[model samples]
Target chain A: MTKLTHRRLSPHILNRLIEGAPDESLALTDDHRRSLTARFRAVASNDHRRLDAWMVERAGLPYEPFRWSPASARRVVGNAALRRSLSEPTLTRGDAVALEVSDQLLRATSGYARPGSLASWLAQSSPSVVGLVSAEAANWATQLDEAAQELERPWSVAPSDAYYDVARARTTLRGRRDLIVPRGLTRVVLRVRAGAPGKSAGPGLRADLTIDALAEPTGLAASRVIGLWPEAGVVLSVDGTMEDLRAGARDLVRTAVAWQRHRLARAA
Target chain B: MTSLLDTTPVSVMDVLRGERDARPIANTTAASGLRAELEDGIFALLGPARRDAPLAIRASTLRSGTYAEDLTASLLAQVRGLLVTQALRLLSVGLEIDHAFDDALLAWRADVGSNELTRFVDQLESDERARLATDVTAHCVTLKRSLGPLSSRWLPRTSLRAYQRLAGGDVVLRDVIDLMVGTTTSDQASVALLDVTTSPLGEGAERVMRYHALVQTLRTSIVPLRTSMFSTAAGELWSANVDDELLSRAVGDVLETLRVMTVAP
Candidate 1:
């Protein structure tokens, strides 16, 4: 009798499992990480299609390119606020941090050469519309400030958003780390979300950590990933491992598939 | 207080737009008297209640806290934010299509907190969530239909909040303007304020616009040119040129509200 190998679960499939079992905590053991990594590698090798090709061809998705600044503002704002607060040791109150973050965002707008430069956009546009953008920025900064207050450790490296590009896959990933404080040999990646952890939050954090992990060179992985929902005064922590990357890759595939299905439905 | 000059009053929008037609307010005496009356009424309540603590009031609290009223306000604000952001993107970079209602909503939820609206939905059972989602979807459609065309021309500065103290900081009045357009000046009205509401047009809605104008007037010596209120539910707009009379009327209403609040409490 011929030996049979079971089909490896895709990121989407794993995500469904994660979503179904919300009560199950995601504490991946080292052995589990290795097994997951092997499964991820096997799946990637067997699947000859590149991400870009799958997105464009299989999904039939038109490349609706978006500016990075607005989509990634939540992550960027938190990190920037923390960096500014840390720079000025006297600044303690979240409100003060909130104001600083607001200023940073407003200042950064001047350098925005992107198609949707908020400053330039507001300058020509009606003054009333500027309020929406400013209010949005203010709210985000406030939340970040609250998150910053909750974070006890002093950050060694200044917080910033990062971009990772893989030439072979033609994939670009953006990672926003609220604070990156080094503890011994491992760097902790903290993410500040607005409210309490929802159903998708666990997988979402894993996906975020995966991007951060892949963005770094091999062997220098993030030791821990912490998701902070400041409004709820809650902290969710997960180990950063190769399993996260595998899960993230599966999520990417799932996202493409969902996009394809949506496109096809619309076309029909 | 500056005395009224015997001159023709300009429309508030024109002053805000910085048009040459901008002029001083028409009836400063009546306006001042009305304001004084309101202040007296407020002090009547505040003076006896608690001398040690300053009264704190939010502009939102002035309105009825009915579910419908709260829901409408929140919905209008959300729609305004969504439209403004889309308009910014369209004007600056130009997208092939602005985000659909669902996409815009997702973006809105991301930017805003898990607010009352989210909480309202979350507390509901599965069946209730389905029904509420359907109702909300329909409401969203109506709002989009009303707001889509208006979004491009608005070019507003949204969520402008201000506080004013009367009677030596014992009485504090707060107001938040949903949207402000054009420029503001000390000598001439140079800005137009737009207050968006989800509720149908009513006296309360009008008073809210007046409160916003009053706040702006206190902040900038020159009264704003036009104060307009838009109702998303009815898709109707009512705009009045800002004069001392309008600001004074708003002051009176606020005072009356305070009188009721402080005394009733």
Candidate 2:
């Protein structure tokens, strides 16, 4: 950790995570990853047929990959904008952050989002509309990230979002980490959400921890996962532990099973 | 670009930021305390808000929306205000406003997301649309004149949303700040909110400002340094520091708004 001369009793969330959070990786060994992987695979294998059926249907149908346009996709673009704002200068300048995010959306969604998609709306929209889209997308992240702008650098590094392909299953369990702070080999992941976090937030954090941990081949999972609901003004942080990973795996499997069963039943 | 008001000794922003002489500004802790109080007060008097149909409170819901009951003029005023706000955001972000109305309209439609609202807006007759466009351009000019080019140091954020579910999901308070400047550091409170409007300042306008302050406090624990509302139509700006008295008024306003919603059929 980069040491500061003096730290307050209760610093802001950024300071707490960067300066005070423990290294969760310290507790994990190769043995833990192997066990966690095996545990998930064992359960997932039981419902392989159902899982494959769901994956097949998922790819067969058309769907829009969520991305920001000038005016839509607040969460998707907001997180990215926040990370970019943390490192870049002059972001607070007229619509700079939003405009950059707009360009990013166009690049990310090209040939992916359907032609009539909102992500494609910016290309045909007027200058003011484009400005509006950029502003809306950048505003939430700016509000959250700018609050801690004075903190030292590298705290708001772009989070490495992961997609863990389920072992022996056709589905990818996606995990989102908004911001990450490094502490030696171990790291802490922060997720900035839009509104009041609900009861599902706990299971959501567990799932995030499990997916992020397993995505890495050799590295340990982040020491902590923080869920921030900017609208609600709340932060929830969960330590990465074996027990937490176990719960995360179980919830992921249970949720997949229930969802697959519902989808198959609907198709029938 | 220099502001139209640059000729004046003190600009509008200077006036808004001028009240720093007050000691002990509002911080996130006080805001948190108010949240708990507001939540407790709701359950104590009004009972819990029903999960199925909670009051989604907005600024327009104030004064029982008596003036906005399908009045075409009021609707035009609302749209005009939105366009002007959009114009300011666009200009702030470095977009040229050659056709202010059309540019803002495109962004506004995308943000609105309601098919009904967009459909109504898109279906306007050519003459009405032209007139509306002219009015919006004029308002945008006023906004540009008043706000000027805000320096990046202030960390200007546009259309900042304030949404919080209070009373354990019974009452949902939502508002939008046209422009927000400054933010809290680890030590001090520095956030300020500006609500841009088409109408002149009145009792209703002040109520909306108080409402914005309260919702913003709950949304971001950092109490704002000051909250101001500028009427693009009148070129008038009303600003006040966030203090215990203002927050107290906000809490009362929220409970009272919820109470009215609870009793209404």
The candidate that achieves the highest lDDT relative to the unseen native structure: 2
- Model 2, B1-265: lDDT tens per residue? 8766647655567765665555354465776678888888788766644567766778766523332332344666767877788788887666777888888887777666556556666888999888999899888888777776566567677876667777666778888788887765535667778888888788777777788888887766667778888888899988888887898888887777677666666
Choose the strongest candidate by TM-score. 2
- A1-268: candidate 1 lDDT, tens digit per residue: 1111111111122122222222322333455345534443443322232232124222335454443333344344434544555577665323333454446546546665344554343344332233233334434554444334433455543345545554344345455566675655566766655433444555566566655665665535566666655333335555654566556546655644555456567679
| Distance from true location, Cα of B264 in model 1, Å | 1.9
Model 2 achieves a DockQ score of 0.44
- Which 10 consecutive residues of model 2 chain A have the lowest summed lDDT? A1-10
| Tens digits of lDDT, candidate 1, B172-200 | 76666665654432234446776655557
Candidate 2 lDDT at B34 equals 86
lDDT of 2: 0.66
Q: Candidate 1: where are CA atoms >4 Å away? A: A1-268, B1-39, B48-54, B59-62, B65-104, B115-117, B125-155
lDDT of 2 at B139: 87
